[model samples]
Target: MGCTDSKDNLTPEELAIMNGELSLMYQAYQASDVDLVYRKYSNDGIININQWQNVSSKLKLAAYSAPMPPKIQKFYDSLKAENKYKLRDLLVIGIYLSTGKSIDKARLLFEAYDENDAKVLSKGDIQQMTSFIVEVAVEKTCVLIQDDDPNNVQPEEMAKFLQKLRTVKNKGKQELCKMFLGGNPALTELTMEKFVENVTMPSTVQLLTFQGVRKFIKKQEVTASKFAALTSLKKPTGPSDPKAELPKAK
Candidate 1:
């Protein structure tokens, strides 16, 4: 009970590195990159973390539980303050594992790690969440375009609409135009699977059209951004689109 903290041994270098401001320290812990992880902490031949609980007891539990690289403790610690729920369950054990004790313990911890509901989270969690959102957005766009009507417009025009939809800055405006002009056929042609393969799910995908579609892109520019006059626009699907009906007399 006198002084049993494991982290108490702060080598001079560890104090200097109190972080080089590189999240790499965190990654090193994850990769088990001893060199980099060594840069961030000191082991004073004993654990003496000055925190919510006793350092030795903390390491013992972490050595037996927790998931993710032990260094993520920093991120989790920050999250604990705000998203107490997100880290409460994971960090209690994660706090222990981040110490770089033993992978065997990590594996065991993972097995029983679901001890609590996924704890809440913190602003720090946004980094990973942002990446995931981008992926989802890209995929959603692709699926929305599949099943082109094939008529009432050509595949060429359909494709142009998609290009603009992505390039445009505002989602609300893009939605308005698409609704007013009816569905863009090119988009209907792009399937969810194809979209995911060709574009970043959550990112901007540059859509290029053949010469004909390029013509459409320009035409839209000239039409004061409104749908072209009925007389100026040609049949929707060119000679394709099996389901498209014929144009009636003026």
Candidate 2:
């Protein structure tokens, strides 16, 4: 469980690459420049984490959905903890422009950080991001899944779903990802309505402890026997498939 070193402890070579370089990282991600972001973070092996780990495929999707170097760099401190705890301040900056649901969750999560204020996630944020992310994943996975059996994902669960998709071999996971995306807990009827019908609401509920979901996914297929064993009880479906898989490990 020991970590290597904090970003502060990085050598001059590393520091030159990462210090106060968030905007550069964001630009790299926006342009979908994998190599640039990779060079930036390949310097740091830190795996950004969150509750979405319960489903492996979901997490993988988020990482590859775009170059998330800024998100990775910002969440560096919090996601590095040996235990499961969220870094609210870190999430706000990266997720604000992420998507609407993500923005909403980020707002609520940020509010929780500022518990005295009782702030919440915004409606407009969720709708926009959902539309953008889903449109992308559906387009990518639909073509890939049929031809090469790639990850078919819906936007709502994209973040949570991809976070966990990185654990094992991407091959087997591809075969089972449809079930994963299909089994997605789904945005609530009310939440889905907002993005679908463009209804408006003031704020939405954001679960605090629920952020640990990704941690749960890493353990889903502890072993092949257990993987099959667990299913004996209720005929478990394979792990959830994120819309896409991460190029990096979570």
Top TM-score prediction, candidate number: 2
| Per-residue lDDT of candidate 1, residues 1-250 (tens digit) | 0111133553222222222212222222332332222222323312223332232232332222345334434433433433232322332223222334333222222222222324322222322322222222222222222232222344566455545533432332343223212234234232223322332221112111011112233334555445446466776655576546566669
The models' CA-based lDDT, in order, is: 0.29, 0.30
Off by over 4 Å in 1: 1-78, 81-109, 116-236, 241-250
Model 2 clashes, total count: 35
Q: How does each model score on TM-score?
A: 0.19, 0.20
Q: List candidate 2 stretches off by more than 4 Å.
A: 1-93, 96-188, 192-214, 223-227, 230-250
Candidate 1 versus truth, CA RMSD in Å, comes to 21.8
Scored by Cα lDDT, where does model 1 land? 0.29
Least accurate 10 contiguous residues by lDDT in model 1: 203-212
Worst lDDT 10-window in candidate 2: 204-213
Q: What is the Å distance of residue 29 in model 1 from its true position?
A: 6.6
**How well is each residue in 1-250 modelled by candidate 2, as lDDT tens digits?**
0112464553332222222222222322221222223223321323244332321132233333344444433433333467433333223323322223433443333332332342322333333333322222222222212211123334434433343333432322332222212223242222232332221122212111111121222334356447767777875365466535545765
